[model samples]
Target: MNILLAVLTSAIAVGGTLIGSWSTYLFQRRTAERAEAVNREERLRQERLAAFSTYAAAVTELKRGLITLWFRRRRALRDQDTREELQAAQLDSDRLGAAAEAAAFRLRLVADDPGLRPLMTAISTHLGAISHAADRQAVIAIEARFEEAVTAFIDAAAARVQ
Candidate 1:
């Protein structure tokens, strides 16, 4: 009887140790998975923030170039020297526009928000229209629209990143 009891006790002890070890392993695995998920979310948020910042800076620079181009075009009709300036302005504007478009595409790729596309398009459309404006007043009006679009985009992006 004593021998039988000792063997039974040993078996139960072994079974309990295995069960405890398995439970600990499961708990640790779950904790590691949760940590990994949190880290991934943080990394995505950082990427989105960087993309949004780059897009904003590129768009702002493009807006400045487009406005300069508008003034240069207006002056080119009356001044011979302004024609050269206008050509330079045109090149700058083209380069800036391409940069802004690239930034927008990057932002679009990183952003999960669907509404951002139209806002981004609106800004680009308005910025493009500035150079085609009939007068300074028209350019100013388009600039205002561009600012509004940018504001909308920034607000939306801010919400998404948070």
Candidate 2:
């Protein structure tokens, strides 16, 4: 009877040890999974921030190119050299515009907020109108709109990153 009691005690101790080990493993796995999920979210947030900044920078560059083109066209010089220079500027402006569009598309892909698309469209429309501005006043008005759009985008991006 004593031998049987000893065996029973030993079996209970082994079973308790197994239960404790299993519970510890489950708890550790859950903790690890939670940590991994947090890390992944952080990484995605960082990627979105980078995409927003890149899109903003690209838009700024394209705006600068368009303004330059507008000024060059306004000069209305018809000499061969002037015409060549204007053509080159136009090509450069086109390239910058394409780059800005590509950046905007990338931003769209990563943006978490649904409102960003309309803001982006507004910016693009303002940018397109800049070259067609008839006078300094028109340009100024378009520029104001452009600046507002840019500010709105920055604000939205800041909120998202936070």
When summed lDDT is taken over every stretch of 10 residues in candidate 2, the lowest stretch is 75-84
Model 2: colliding residue pairs: none
Per-residue alpha-carbon lDDT of candidate 2 for residues 1-162, written as tens digits (9 for 90 to 100) = 999999999999999999999999999999999999999999999989999999999999998889888877877453434876788889999999899988888887888478787888889999999978988899889989999999999998889889
TM-score for predicted model 2 compared with the true structure: 0.89
Clash count for candidate 1 is 0
Collision pairs in model 1: none
Candidate 2 segments whose C-alpha is farther than 4 A from its true place: 76-81
Q: Model 1 lDDT vs. the true structure? A: 0.88
Lowest lDDT sum, 10 consecutive residues, model 1, at 75-84
The whole-model C-alpha lDDT of candidate 2 against the native structure comes to 0.88
- How close is each model in CA RMSD to the real structure? 2.0, 1.9
